[model samples]
Target: MGMLCGMAALSLVLGHADARGDAPPPAKKPRLVRAPAAAQPAPAASPEAGLLRGPATVPAHWSRNHCPDSIPEGAAYYIVVKGDTLWDIARRFLGNPYLWPQIWDKNRCITDAHWIYPGDALIIPEVNVVAPGPGGAGAGTEETPAGGGPTGARGPSTPGQILFPSIEETALQCASYVVDGREDESLRLVGSEQGATKVAFGDRDILYLNKGSNAGVKAGDVYTLHHETYAVKHPDSGKAIGLKIEVTGWVRVILVQENTATVMVEQACADIHLGDYLKPFERVQVPLVVEHSRPTRLTPPSGKVVGTVVDMQDDASIAGDRQIVTLNLGTANGIAPGSLFVLYKVMYPSVPTPRIVLGEAVAVAVRDRTTTVRILNSNDAIMNGDKAELQ
Candidate 1:
């Protein structure tokens, strides 16, 4: 009886399996299909990529509508809007449109002076205003004597209410001058890493310097890159006084080896090239002073010292206002930087002719026997060999 019961149970289980044999195959498991990742957009090229001094990052407090209430010490903020220009902004805030470069110097994010976006933020530098009192506004004030005084004598001063801007930093940095002696050639721009496709280098270009740690060069050392253009001859004596050097650019040492150093072009006023000489960097600042009024009537020579305009930087036959010219008079003639000169023309030394006044210039850089002057104003074209009298 037990065997028969077991046989019956096994047959029932087999019958149930046979009934489900034809039943639908097991359901398929769904496969996951991921969507393609969204494509990332490329970064826009900066218009001022190689011109900027440092890496640019958008300011955290930047806004198009309003500037932040809190600002950096000694600095104010300005939010750019459409149709805004650096020139206009400078005139509106600094009271001088020519001071736009100062505004540009303060804001590193601005790449091009021509294009400032509406959302961009700018830093307005504080202008030093003189207060009314001695040693402040009218301390050094002097009147233009009916008869001109000696060269060392002060020229006429502008009113205390007027303010003049200093020389543009770029002009002062790239200024070419006549040197009494050859610049030290110990350091030179030997080569560059740009291979051979490029002959001219500009701002931020990597370059190799011939000088290194052995020559007192170290990381962070700054130098002025320049090249001698030609020898300057005295207009009257007809003798070689010095060589004229054209500043190509500036560089900073990044790595120093035994006999070589790696440098980067910091500020480029012109194209830099191999074989350019280097000198210890100098910081030049042309101070602000009361501008002298242009002399309208003929003024007698100061008789302190007389010189001639030897050459001009541009080599143009004629120079007008705000041009750079080389002068034969220098420190030896009691000519110092910021000294004023009255430009004139005397056709004949023997014959008495009217001292034709041309323009005025100020000594910017002075050596023992050579000086560089920037023509402040000119009613007529100033040329080489024009007479410059100390004022």
Candidate 2:
């Protein structure tokens, strides 16, 4: 009877606790637990990342549309868009368009200020506003001198800006001599500079000409001197195709007479002699365009190996990197200045295919039947007998 009474009392106590909403502390309300924060993804790398330091950043032009006026600190990047320039990026980010060099120095993919293409993600560093001063905008800045400092005009020359000679300069100064021995009735060297009677002459020497005003030649007229080398023979028939000529030198007429004139040797590729011949000079000029890679979809054009390395510009027997060489192929064979050719050495020309590619060259000057080429690159020493085909 006591046990029953105790159980009844306990039941009554539990029922009262439930009515007061206190059952086992309501399961502790799940402790209102919170979950951990999620991890953020890292930024994607750029295709030109190898050429740069830190992360790739974009120009401020991108922020004009999408970002706030003030950018956060630390590494940033931007996708390149059409019409965006380094100058514009500098002005937008650094508050100075002349400071584009700072961004350029930070990016190696930007080989040229004028050549950045769309889709390139440029790096944007922190704003480093520099006051205009003498000299220029500072190192890595463009040549925009403000106040009294000499701009790049009179300052020390910037390296890499003039590393290679222009095509016009090379053509005028470094063209090879074409040997022309065939007798021409009208064109023949009469005498040396100042009539010194020297057997061989060179640059800056004055010469006496046989034809002047009567032959439509006048003072200040430029002429090319050449000599007949030999007639090129057909490999199959041993028949002569054409007479190959050699360039002797160039002359500028200073004084003119009815049948005689005083000419000055402007440039001499070889020794100017009493028997050299002359014709009106044709100005040759072509801008140098360095190719980073071979053209795609456009395979190298097919052409015959028609020339030999008659001579080297530096008088070296074997030509290598950056050496100048003369080839028999020229405008007459559809070769022009700036034309690229692949050098090859085939033991037997009778074979249908080129045996091996030795190197590459670029034409700096094109004459009637010859061209002056500079070795762009080479694997083997370019010898005199190595053949070259259009690339």
Candidate 3:
């Protein structure tokens, strides 16, 4: 009964609405809702896009976003980005965006800071980033600094010139390090060769090395190839052990393979054959500090600790064409900054003398003057000119 009444009331309301519709009712439109605005995109940095207007043969740049506020007037920093823009990042690193171009110009690698994606590393430059003007990268026909060349600017001369102590020309400025591992090699014929043609060993074959290019094998790479030979006593009481061939000699790795490699056959006098095993003929990597192993007691006959000059950062020491090339020495060698000692040359002494009897090595960086030599938290190397001796 309730349902019937409800239906009847609905019909009445519908009928009433239809009767009133004759008064010309218009069409109804649905309301639309507006969406919230999004954040604005960062402004583009207008780094100079022209010729090579930078100092030296090489130049670098801040290849990351910058925070405008953090950047100081003349500080060195690599641009990084997490939630920042070039201007913001610049300000954060350099303290100003007007100095962005100076940083941009010095960092020639950063051609397009916009395209600088995350994870791409950059080499930040030191102070005195010359801009594009008379002292900067401005194109002009005027006098330039001595080391400035045409586009670069040279700083005024100073008195704290630090030059690297002269070393033997033999010890090269090699790209990497070299080691010593030798065991007085010797090769000799085994038995009589009266009629040894096509002997019992003819059944065994040998694998010869055919070295190829690109291995960078510039001589002195030893290859040890071996073959087993078993034999019994002919007409004796005791058994004698036969000697398998253990040949070794320096070779140039010519043909490099995916897994297997080929090397030149340097010594073939021992009647070499086909099936001989080959690999790097390694002796022994003597400890950084080894005891008596050399023919002479003075020498170590093994590996030695080595280091190189990774940086030279003394502005005052860079005058007079003399770069204060710091060495890989210091407290590790029992040196401290300002700790004075006579420089000596590292020489291998003769019979009566011991190896590395120091003679004359130029005094290099002091603790402070040395590159990457710190005397802070843990241990700092002594200043340049400190004595370098072998304990």
Give the top-scoring candidate (lDDT). 1
Q: Candidate 3, residues 241-312: lDDT per residue as tens digits?
A: 122223322233444444334454443324444444445543211000001111222424121112223222
lDDT measured at residue 78 in model 2 versus the true structure, 0 to 100: 56
Cα lDDT of model 2 by residue, 1-391, tens digit: 1111110111112112223332122111111111112211222334353223343334443121232333234445555455555655554454434334456655545533444554565666553321111222111111111221221111111212221222334233435444334546486688865565477888788889888789988887778887765555433345343555567768888999999998888777777788788887653332233333532223343433345565565456788876777776555455555556677677787777635667777776766656678776787788776766654
Regions more than 4 Å wrong, model 2: 1-168, 171-174, 177-185, 193-197, 232-241, 293-318, 323-336, 347-354, 365-372
Better by TM-score, candidate 2 or 1: 1
Model 2 residue 64 lDDT? 19
TM-score of each: 0.60, 0.45, 0.19
TM-score of 1: 0.60
Question: Tens-digit lDDT track for model 1 on 1-391?
Answer: 1111111111112113323232222112211112112211211223232111112343654332233334444334565555566655655565544435556656645533444555565666654322111221111101122223334422222233343432444676688888878878878988999978889999889999876888889897778999988888866667887888899878888899999999988888788989999998765544333444676546766544677888997567888787888887766555655677789887786898788899888776777877788887888888888888776
Model 2 — TM-score against the truth? 0.45
Model 2 lDDT, full chain set: 0.52
